[model samples]
Target: MRDLPVLTGDAVADAATDWPIAEHRVLGRGRLNTFVSDTVVTPDGATMVRDYLTHTGAVGVIALDEQERVVVVRQYRHPVGFKLIEPPAGLLDADGESWLTAAQRELAEEARLRADDWRTLVDYMTSPGCLQESIRVFLARGLADAPRPEGFVLEGEEADMEVCLVPLDDLVAAVFAGRVQNPTLVVGVLAAHAALRSGREADLRAPDAPWDARGAKAARDQELGELEAP
Candidate 1:
């Protein structure tokens, strides 16, 4: 049997430290144009270089229809080169857009539906080792047909995207069977199924749940205005 470690600790506990970014450089930029490389000094004073993507964050919605079916969309992801089945999701690029608002917009744009009840299922960082993208998943229920947000035209893969209403359990089975492979969809379906089976709706967070690590460091850096001499 393979050895595994079971970690048990107080999640609410954290250690405080003022880490320093000794140096920074812009390697290049792409469609998400921004400076995204860095050199920093560890607390122990060791120098290290790192590169990461900068994002404004994102949201995914697990939209449930009247029959308790989940909304699934099949779209092509260029980088991964896969036509993955996924839930409605989008980047939080709109100025001053709150997380819940972004989730609502993405749901409306991709699924063309709105919900009567919304709860935050989970918030996580995608590929934290090399990406600075923070994502939140929301559980949306009481869905009904609606028009897409104004001027939100679908183009490219999104224009030709295929959407289907899938039974929640069937979607969960597809996730486990390697048929549905999008990160957001897998996480969401498994979570939603477990929550529904366990009757743990009371444990769900409100739509406005605080995301502490959602670019708080960048905001803090902007406030501190250079913590140490260059």
Candidate 2:
């Protein structure tokens, strides 16, 4: 295997400023820095580079129930132009909560269901070229209905959302028929399949789900062992 190239710089040099919608302060810088700016592109395909902030990876969950139904939410995505089907997910706001904790919180807030079992599906980079956005996906099962958490409203920015439970077969058919098209959801479904085939669904947990450095290594080891054994 070839080693990846690493760049080291003491300070960030602001290159030539292109036309931006609005100028904003830089959020961070180092390996990757972030800035906030209004960047817009015309319909004619003209490109406009603007100031934008870079962020780390986010988390998402594909919560399933005992009946083989997958919990999904229909939310209006500004960039997508309409409501899209997606699993329960959200940004991690609390400083110390683990990714699995965020997944549990999102599931409860979006679907009002708390899963008893969870197995990580995979870690994915949503966009790597211009933006630094990674998403961690999980497979949650053994769900039960519960009360929505306090202050768990998708107000203002996320007001137009409808949550539902969908059958797994329906989801698979949609994928094969070219209906479900989100990359994160696709990865989650494929991971769920591998978990089902190997009967490894019992391993993922809220306190110990593989989302970080050591947990990720352990999960990968378990998966590799399963593949290598008879």
**Top-scoring candidate (lDDT):** 1
Per model, state how many residue pairs clash: 0, 4
| Superposed Cα RMSD, model 2 | 14.2
lDDT of 2: 0.67
The global Cα lDDT (0 to 1) of model 1 is 0.82
Clashes in predicted model 2? 4
Question: Can you write out model 2's per-residue Cα lDDT over 78-186, one digit (the tens) per residue?
Answer: 7677667888888765778888888888888888888887666777656644554567888877888877888766695457678887887788778888888767667
Worst 10 residues of 2 by lDDT: 14-23
TM-score for each predicted model, relative to the true structure: 0.88, 0.65
Error of 2 at 230 (Å): 60
